[model samples]
Target: MANTTALLFFSLAAFAACSPSTCTFIPSTNATTTNYPGSSFIKTSAYPYNISVLSEVPIATICTSPTGNRTAELACARIYIDAIDEQLAFLYARRLGYAAVAGASKFATNTSLNDPSRNDVVAAGMAAKVLKYGATEAAGAVMGGEGCMIYAALKYEVETIQEECNNKFTVDVERVCK
Candidate 1:
């Protein structure tokens, strides 16, 4: 009876520890609530970006890896940066495409992009560091082809800010591009 109880306890503990459903990425409280002058753009665009990235980069795979903690940290940073990129896209669209005077005024006044203390900026810095680590790791080992290539490209895109999260919040390119 004692041995059976111990076995059950260990089994339950292992299940709790390994459950993928328990793992989730939550944004920083400040990032979630930040209300910049033109924050509506960010609020609208962030969800799809989060969903797209989350789908492309399987949380279970990253969360279960030996370096799971680092990978999960990078994932969170990627989500936050994607949100911020939405704001930047809105600013650019408003300025160059729509010629909105209000957007220009907001862009001139909004200092969040340059402020190192802002949640988005802090998250970007963290993402950059982790991506460098991931790229190094990728280069050192065999990544098993397409999945590994996708991860590498994601790190590159995050590092370069080449793929901005626009109004579309599309990750189609990230999914298919090699």
Candidate 2:
């Protein structure tokens, strides 16, 4: 329960940290996305993640308590991971497009990953491993005292997704984004 709660909190924080440039797609204009005046647009912090199969993920309830539903709970977490991954991928795609039209670091907070020694980056790596092996085991991936790890996974996944989207988009990210 505590772990899932932490994961939710950190995930929200991570999303807020990285979701500015790609919050909403402006129709018919690649050159203009949303220029959030001041800091960043935190649209996703409260927006629904749009998980398909399950309606609402009661992370505290079905995640780890009442060992009888372990299988379902684990499945629930894995599904959440996938959904979160998809959202991250989508955010990456849009951010790439926004960066192309806008500058590389216009709306992004700490866009540079130069400082590999950063604690968040290291913990995100740990989160990555948790995500990697969590595919099957899934205990630490979704349950237990791994909220920060899960949040890191989401955080680091943004970088990876951004690179992938850059390679895949960039050329027409501006035009095609419309």
Per-prediction RMSD in angstroms?
24.4, 20.2
Tens digit per residue, CA lDDT, model 2, 1-178: 9999999999987665446454332222322334221114324333234432244533444466476777787786775566556554544455445433333342234253222334334444545666775433344333312343333333433444455323222221110100
Native-to-model Cα distance after best TM-score fit, residue 89 in candidate 1, in Å: 0.4
**Model 2 regions more than 4 Å off:** 1-61, 102-178
* lDDT, residue 93, candidate 1: 34
Candidate 1, superposed: residue stretches over 4 Å from native: 1-68, 97-178
Highest lDDT: give the candidate number: 2
- Please report the candidate that would top TM-score against the real structure: 2
TM-score of each: 0.21, 0.28
Count backbone overlaps in model 2.
0
List per-prediction Cα lDDT, in the order shown.
Answer: 0.38, 0.42
